[model samples]
Target: MNPPKRPGRRAVCLLVLFSVWWVAVATVGFSAETVSSEPQVKAAFLINFAKYADWPSNAFEKANSPIVLGVMGDNKVSEELQKVIAGRVINGREIVLKRANSIDEAGACHILFISNAEQQHTPTVLDQVKGHVLTVGESPEFLEKGGVINLVRKDQKIALEVNLTAADKAQIKISSKLLSVATLVKGKAN
Candidate 1:
């Protein structure tokens, strides 16, 4: 008789990430597209992270204010996110996608995404938005630059690297479920 089999570690990890990704996508009604680049995936993660993180009341100007994603120095991610966020509301607030060219512009958002294109200005931007924004980045040195959550590539797939110190400083409370799937870091840097 053949033995019963369980899922492998890699399969289980993929399943968890995929399930979170799917639920996030479903919440925003993200349309299925033939994504051609990493930007799209990062956009998805940005939305997913936004759903999982909680910010202070001051992050929003009003109770009905939008949850804004201020994407810095990358139009592709911004554009793809616009599609996913179009007319979507979460926790009774609308989702707004925007592009930012400077730290000042990025500071006004609930969620800030710093692209590799803006790597040189990451420190300044991270400093500007500290204690309020849910910061996400695609660069390897993002968490080191004082960002909260950084997306990384592992085994040819995208994974999450979370800096709890940064998140705590930013006052963004990330769900334990989200943290369970991430590579957690401590004490400001990885």
Candidate 2:
């Protein structure tokens, strides 16, 4: 049997930096009411999340299928994500972005980012993608509604809340490294 490869010094350093940043965001609440939009930063986080999540073998259509990131509503975030993912690859799969308008469209995506514009239809979206996709949203309500991850703006910085129950139901495995930095929660959005 082969032994697991340990992380290199550089990887450990990066992990430490990420952990510190997450701790700062989680512990020290942002105090500012209004700050500049951070779509680019959010987009970066989304990409990194893909690297830290494990999907079922059937999630992709084929061995060489690309990881499809579907954006439903919020053109700005979609555009930002598209720009960041351009030519990027995760787990040997190229990253692709798609604008989705319906549940069926979103079901084909590996990661579905539901924007505030689609807030009203969150339930339907979640139902459609349940057990097959990683659903991300920007509101606490999303976590309540069975979303796997919620990106919230605290004060001015971004914070994460993960729904482990939802992820387990969907058969997705979120890395321990990612969970170490996120505030874990569980429930259906009311």
Candidate 3:
């Protein structure tokens, strides 16, 4: 009888890659029961952003400091984000959601989701938070204005637009698994 053949190295590598990609997509993508509103989807993105991102050591007060996600300009998004992240811990740090009253207040957060309601103040807000936090906005001019990441709407589907240069300048390291699914963009250098 012929001996059973083992999977080749290339096959193993492909399997590993596929598993990682599946976990990333499955966790962020909408499941049947959770299939709901746009705000909830954005909230899921925010939660996964914390998972697939690496912040500078000094960004936190200590090893145990909570990672804060601040939301500005839309009450629905903030509420949704809070509901999704409650009792969850990310990167060994507790996840906390804050409804920011102003752009200045959000500057201190680890991830800031600037809602479409704040569209008019995009430039100014981006200027204030540049190189400070991960900024996710839905506007077309968001990444051009120095946001680290933007959630773009294309072909009636939600996609991620990443500004690698902006993220590098901010000292943030986004995982390759996350970048693989993003539409990369170049940001204006300082």
Candidate 4:
């Protein structure tokens, strides 16, 4: 069956805005979209990441709420993430984005995207999130630092590196389908 048509002026506006961002990023050096596709690709990755990940029961405070993606810094990425997950649902839970200034402020997030600019505190951030949240980041050393997913820019597109053992330790399941396209690291083949 064919998919339903997307709705409304706001949707169109968002698309246009992102297309501009995508083009600009593709043309410019590593800005926000240079490393990631602003909100669009990031959100898509987050949602798709959810599909690839399995959270144990009780991962959410309420089974019915949307899974929260906690972004622990101020950056263009966070703005995009909020826009992208605006009205989506994940595993019967609605998708939400929460901003955190400090790791301690970031409670109850299922996925955490650590902006590359926050490298100084990555170790502590990872420590705070370990075994609870699936972490994604742009830092190359993220995996080495114990983060689960390292998002990299290759040929101007976002690629992924995953640590299966870390993910498993977080009680998160990685889909073999997703793994097929990702660079698996530091663990047995998924």
Candidate 5:
């Protein structure tokens, strides 16, 4: 078998810098388009975020409780997430994808992906998952609505807006590495 390839110094440096830039430009002037690959990219982000975040000891019911990722709408993003996370394990916990149409149904999840269809119910959903779930959304007003993470599209590229305040209120601890690549914000959810 061939030896595994490692990232070079230049590659590592670029990654670090890219993380910072990705978050910084989330709100800059950019037009939105129906990017065909958006779902795949977002699914990857959702998984990677779990790898870089630390959940509280009590977040799970047991030592082996799977990390439940809840989807709250019917869309390509949910389907893509299911495909990407199938049979994957993070930190020894198997990943589970659950689809829900209501707040109560999604209450037990560790991570909740709010679909555009549910954007109107953002506030109610946030209230339901408060102090527990890591909420993610793609709407421009998601952060203002108290979402933990908002994915913004800029020039066809996805950028992240991380609300540190919201995460703190939910008692979720995000990794410094992940924060380094996201635009940090603080405010009450509207």
Candidate 6:
């Protein structure tokens, strides 16, 4: 054939992309300002979460509808998240974002990201999602308050704090790979 197509342009482009992704996460080490730096990291987390989790049949199995990402309280974080996950798809479903003032309104989301504004109402919200949704937050007390994933800033980089107990109670299975890199917070410890 024609010079046996070398591991050329396509491969080079992929390599570059991979390099960029790595650099991004490395820089995202522990800062909220840089939180938007590695969009792929967030995407990877969502994808992995889907693989390890078992969503309620009504939300995932039967209908096959889009997986919804819900944001409660803070509008800034929601806006940032929307920009990052705009056109991304996970598990054969397009990702959609919904804003809610109350947990009752956000009940349908597969992942609920609670903002600092929601702190005062977290207990009630957590109660509503006790055995259902996966809760994510950026508050310092997130893990202590039973949130499944806490996004914390450390050494100016963004790190994750995971609450296995909360995830287990919600019937959401977090991947060991994710847990391995994250700081595990057990209710008993604190």
RMSD to truth, every model: 8.9, 11.3, 7.4, 10.8, 10.7, 8.4
Q: What is the lDDT of residue 40 in candidate 6?
A: 39
lDDT by residue for model 1 (28-116), tens: 67445563467788878888777789988887889998888888888888888977888777888888887877666777788888888
Task: Estimate, for each residue in 140-161, the C-alpha lDDT of model 6 and write its tens digit.
Answer: 8877777888777787566888
Best by TM-score: 3
lDDT of 5 at 75: 76
Expressed as tens digits, the lDDT of each residue in 118-137 for candidate 5 is 87888888876644788889
Angstrom error of the Cα, residue 60, model 2: value is 1.4
Locate the minimum summed-lDDT window of 10 residues in model 3. 1-10
Give the TM-score of each candidate.
0.78, 0.78, 0.79, 0.73, 0.78, 0.70
Residue-by-residue lDDT tens digits, candidate 3, 101-137: 6767877888888888988887887777643588888
lDDT (C-alpha, whole model) for all candidates: 0.81, 0.83, 0.83, 0.75, 0.81, 0.70
| Local accuracy of candidate 4 as per-residue lDDT tens digits, 44-73 | 786678777878877766668577787866
Candidate 6, residue 107: CA error in Å?
Answer: 2.1
For model 6, the superposed segments whose C-alpha errors exceed 4 Å read 1-52, 56-58, 61-63, 188-190
